[model samples]
Target: MRLAELSERSGVSTATIKYYLRERLLPPGRRITATQSEYDEEHLRRLRLVRALIQVGRIPVGTAREVLAAVEDDSRDQLSRLGTAVEALPHGPEPDESDPSTAVGRRTATALMRQAGWRFSLGIADEFPAFRMLVGAIAALHRLGYACDLPHLLPYAQQAAQLAVADLDLVEEFTTPAEQVEAAVALTVLYEPVLLSLRRLAEAEESNRRFGGGS
Candidate 1:
């Protein structure tokens, strides 16, 4: 398809598409004529991946480039590396940081968790660190004075639980319960450090942004 058509289909602007091409974020399209190029499915796929990383995952361009490179490599560890990168979504500003000690917000969130007698699911702990991060985010919010009202956040939790169940069920074919539990624990430990490190780095980057030092 033509650049105009690609841009319209991808919901990205023409200039942005050109920028992506210049950055080599998008693969080179076929040069159909001296002044014309035609993009194909590969280009569309690359554009979608870039959009997911940039728009949905909130990853920075530099990091996304590295991640895309790692995922595309033919090395044995490429899948694992891609999995890790997928889990490293940008967490934007912590809502807890806004007002961590409120009775109806962050604090309320914690109290509700304790009341619900919730235990960290071992099934997910080993496979996805987002569970641990969610817990940490809640705790951090409580510490920062936000009232984590259980009632208010219950809908979000319910939706998350539904998604978790679906995900677990989907993966049941790949591993047994015992193996899943082990993987969950391993994933949690492995991802914890990565999460902390990335968060620190993000903080520094955010600081630079505030100080007019970041591009």
Candidate 2:
């Protein structure tokens, strides 16, 4: 299709599509003439991914470039591609390992992972993006005078493990690496609210059962 058709199909403006091409977020279309280019399904797929990352995921352009590179890198296996994409996400800001308080949190975080047997790549667990998120949350909870102890965290960790398995199973349901990787990215960004809402609803039900409170 032409640029106009692409824009219409994607529900994005032609100006925005031009911007994406200029930014190299979307691959350049095939040259049909000196001034015009032809787009195909591949361009559409890439455009959708770019839009999802930038619009829905709110990923910065530089980060999206890195993530798109990771996603399109056919050299790596599918799992590696998924990991690379995940590493680019803002699970938490870069950790301050030098800060004593952050170090304390890191220790607790690692301890929790250890007790839960949450296996990770050797020496890379501490560097995982979510590791920083966990450390920050635990540290903040400690500052709030809450016990960020294993007993309280173990069930969450177990549930996370189960969720990971289920997520991977869903990813594996797609046969192609591209489809699987895209599913992983989409689910990672989109499903957190679903899980969080379910948790809250379950808590409410439990509260009602125990306290006999009105909805």
Q: Give the local distance difference test score of model 1.
A: 0.60
**Model 1 alpha-carbon drift over 4 Å, by segment:** 32-35, 56-58, 74-82, 92-132, 141-162, 165-215
For all candidates in order, the CA lDDT equals 0.60, 0.83
Kindly give the stretch of ten consecutive residues in candidate 1 with the minimal lDDT sum: 180-189
Candidate 2: tens digits of C-alpha lDDT, residues 1-215: 99999999999899999999999889899999999999998788788888888888888899888887888898998778999987877676665666566776778888888887766742587667788888888877766678777788888888998999988898799788987887788778777778889999999899998899656
Which one wins on TM-score? Answer: 2
Ten consecutive residues with minimal summed lDDT in candidate 2? 118-127
Candidate 1, residue 24: Cα displacement in angstroms equals 2.5
